[model samples]
Target: MKNSKVFLSLCAVLFILPSLDAQTKRIKRPKSRVGVGSVDRFVQESFDLYDKVYKYDGYAAAGTPLDDDDIDVLEEALEEMTVLSESAPDIIDDLDGVGVLKQGKATLQMNKAKKALKYSIKTAKELLLGQREREAQENEDDTAETESGDSPDISGTSGNQKDGADVEAEEEPSNISDKLEVYSKFDFVPGDKLLYFDDFSQDFIGDFPSKWNTNGTGEVVTVGSVEGKWFELKGGYGIQFLPLLSEALPEEYTIEFDLLAVVDTKTSSTARLNLTLADNNEFRDGPNKSSVELPLGQFGAFSIRVFNRINGGTVINSSLNANLRQAVLNKPHISVAVNKRRFRLWVNQKKYVDIPQFIAPDKALSHIKFNLLGMRDGVDRLFITNLKVAEGGVDLRRKLMAEGRISTNGILFDSGSANIQPRSLGIVRQISQVLMQDQSIKLNIIGHTDSDGPDEANLALSKARANAVKEALVTIYKISEERLTTEGKGESEPVGDNTTADGKAQNRRVEFVKI
Candidate 1:
């Protein structure tokens, strides 16, 4: 009887298994019918136009009337923006931006689109105004010609052409002569030491990344013409992904990553991406004790939402409104600087959000995750790479005194060149100020590079770079040349992994050692 009962139970399970499988099959997600080809073409065209306009030397083309090609480019961009903004049917001008939100709010994407449209409209108007002005001038000239029997040459401009050409030539140097000049205004500087860095280079393509934990699996996929592998999020329900870090983030650290939003014709109409940083290591454990949400979309406006149980149960919410369409279409670099409760974030090169008190005074982020929360089907693609976390908020003088050396990724250089970028002036000035205060102090300037290309070449480059720094210190800051010595480490020492971009960037650095 016992044997019979056991056999019967096994038979029942086997019999029900097929039905369960059938039910699962019935509930399986349907493949998207809209192809990626249309999306690809749109992306390509948008990028091409943006790149051309962004790199165009407006100074060089000064006083030149809008040509047919220029008008066509602007028109194409205008048409695309119209389609993109209008693709979603429930399009309401709710001054507050796009996507699912606690309240109607504008997003970076929405603002960016609106700004682009505004520019196009303005350009179109300007073009028309210029045409009208030119026509009127022509008519006046024609009347003058009819009366005076002399027509001003179209090729000549009452000596204005020579003046314009001279002005154009002068402006050209400001644009090309110093590529690093703009960087002087870019105040962001990397942290003192590397904490955690990953570019996903070690992870095999098409497989779930080995170093990340996801409630639902995510594959490491490569995009066309894009370098490195990125984790792609795909599932019906939301997925949470966190790096395999042993401990929580430090009190003062910086985090940066590149984000790419993939849009398809089906999904681009109403796409949304939600990311959150929480104290909980795993979301599957239970409800979040504390968390901060960043929802990006609704035409590219992004909001920061925070909820903490420990810190007075206070909820803080804010939004950074700007034009960020290009940031979505292309890869946008996200940089977050955290100094305990204070948080500052930058998208691309623009500082959109700055919160002196971002989190509770007692709490810090333990893990960061990606989610497709409340997102509609179709626009569910995102690519991430070059993640870097480093300790910041350092006291330079204290560190130098304690360690007898100070290394910085601050002193930057042009790629493959020994020329120090102007952006390094801030750090350079700081160092010079310190030296000037202490005339007895002597220092050694060292240069290092990542293991890229050939070792001999890197060694040569490093030496040249070190010497260049020594020269800059002497000439620019008036630092004593006798007090400074130069050396090159090449790839002999590395604080980070060479295989990853973040690691490579960390490795290529300069150091000041007290001698």
Candidate 2:
């Protein structure tokens, strides 16, 4: 009895542990290179089972009573599954590390699965053809009897009825390969780089501006036969992004393009240099519509307005700095360049925006978008083509962490106070959302700052801010303290240059790191 009880206890632990671990495991999702994949397995199996009944005599002879309508539905599902399976790998791989591979031994099996589904659909069509023939023959027989004004006395097979059924069954080929082919091709992958609306599809109903909703003169314009317009970027209008593309854009990368524009104005509007990277809190979430416009000047490398200052986040309207950028407006060539944060814009082969030891482009903006605000007033027209991308350089998140720049979880304070700000409410709200999704994971909110003030002052202030953030989340957000912790780092850590305005802004910020 003792041994039996021990065995039972062992079994109970084994049964409960795996489920408990799964609940606690943090999910890190890698980006999928390809979109669609093979169809769901159960769905494919259902198709195959029903399809065989329609094609081969073997299934018919087994005495199953499934109808033709059911057969039709199954065959259609099979076709769709084949397409999906071809695009998405995980749907069929059912294995760890399978989704990331380009091609492998497992991929071969997936190919077979796809082929089998295709054949299954083909078979079902053939069976449907046979059923239609049977119906036709019965009609023919009844018509003959009615016309003769007599009923047959004997029940016997007729040559005419058999001939009719054969003709009807011959109508559709169960072998899809010999009957028809399905294919998908694209001339252009249309849509904006930063923000995409629901209408980023071929359907007419989804192509509405209200859904994408841009502020200012930025209309959704269509230039020539280039087709549908999702975002029509107007000159001097800056667009703020909602935290898309992971956190920030990648650094040490080549951002090549496929853009279309018209530079018809001599106001240097034609030579608009588009700006893609901007870092500020005003553009983080709802900054009441901000913009950082790029003025692509005519014939000069990306340095004509090298020394200009108009500091409003991003906007449609430009102040004195708008004219300072010197847009030549009517240039007709799409440009490409490699940019470093400090290096700025390099146009037509020259180191422009030549600030020293600059910050690289924001890693949060790892997207395929262009900046077109600067030069193109009326004469500027650009047609974008051939999008190409490659990345290198230090990983932003890792670098920031190495230098104690950004923490995964951090406290936010109200501006200008060591005491926790009321606005840390936003950060608390987001943390609450994360906790709501994950029940087992724990969080730590550590605070840090730039070295503008004394070390003791900064450290104490950081602690106050951190504690305030903790209290608000626990008391107001109602998060359990068992899963929370807070700490403070004074002026000892710095993520950006303490000398520049942008760097100081980054330095004097909260950092959150997962423990």
Candidate 3:
């Protein structure tokens, strides 16, 4: 009777498996607001479920009997697999109208989840059968021992050896050093001097940042699963947010910030975030201005539009589809460099725009403005942080050759971490060029830290960061490791005030000295 029951249960599960596949094929694609975040969350959840099931399968395959709790968990996982498999098709279809970048990611995630679910079902069934067989064998042994007048063996061993069951090994997490290799061709060198820097750390939550002014409402808020404070900008037709600069932007400067957009299918097709350098700091656009506009919606190609005006007359206006829809969904670093009339922009490591005449030569761009267009008031939003504007055009090689040393705050890292920011490679790249040009030049790379943490921890972090820079030069730029030495000064050397934001920004620097 027990065998019959187990057989019936297995038969029922096998029957449902085919039906589930058929249902997925027949179901119509529903209009959903499923964003990249939603798809990522579902994939993570499915993987978690798969992990639980796989562990139980491993134990069962190792000739271990399943405990009551293990069986219950496996039963729950089976139900979860059913639900996840049913939902995957719809979640994948959400990427239909999005750019290939987003589609490719979603498709890969969904396929992985599908395979995990399939293997989970197979393991679950085999586990059930093995448990039933073990129980039956134990009962038969008990009857034989009773008839032979001998005691039953109490050893915790099972003869059932699962054949050909291979568990997949977990992949190792990737390191930042390995990730830096992709930025070998990255040529974005940030400005040498820091003019304006804000990470919103000093601001109170729900309050607008002190250093910025906006025609529309915005407040600093922390996002779920994302680090640091983000200034969330509310969208409207002509909303403009400006950072209050003490002086007009110089002829050579660079601007950088981290951008994240919370969007869905309902996000307007026309919604975009515009970065503008205008003549005036007012809420309106000035006569002389240059703007880079990026679409913030999920349903369109990742495209950028640039507009230039000189003396209240439009001079240059154009747009390009960058095929970066998926990248925009993830938090991306935005870098912009202006050397007199030359304008360049990079999203992370990839340079998207470089124009010789994008900015008018005679016009002075004094103010930086952020504008949001066609986004819903509450449903769609944009968040930005770590805004850094610096004066560029410094000849690092000449300065190093003349002064025998060069120090720069441009080589940034994650908060208290040695992991080099990919954008920071521009400065390091310049150092590598210098090294390549002069093979006999040996140098000492020293790392510094702001006085924010324990002295010992800061010292360790500084050392790790210097070593990371050395690794980048050797691995990415193919510089000789023998010529490069590293040191860490921690917070002992004070070039700037630790008490102020600008001072801290100045203090957290990397120095290359001739040896």
- Show the lowest summed lDDT stretch of 10 residues, model 2: 179-188
Global CA lDDT of candidate 1, please?
A: 0.55
Please give the lDDT score for candidate 2.
0.38
Count the clashes in each prediction: 16, 75, 0
- Model 3, stretches more than 4 Å misplaced? 1-177, 393-395
Q: What is the lDDT of every predicted structure here?
A: 0.55, 0.38, 0.74
Runs of candidate 2 exceeding 4 Å displacement: 1-213, 217-222, 225-230, 236-243, 268-271, 274-276, 280-303, 306-356, 360-390, 393-515
- Give the TM-score of each candidate: 0.56, 0.25, 0.68
Per residue, candidate 3 scores C-alpha lDDT tens digits across 203-249 of: 99999999999877899999997999999998776788999887789
lDDT of candidate model 3 versus the reference = 0.74
lDDT order of candidates, top first: 3, 1, 2
Better of 1 and 3 by TM-score: 3
Please report the TM-score between candidate 3 and the true structure: 0.68
Model 2, span 47-131: residue lDDT tens: 3443343334233333334475655454455445444434444553332212111222233333334444434444334343443
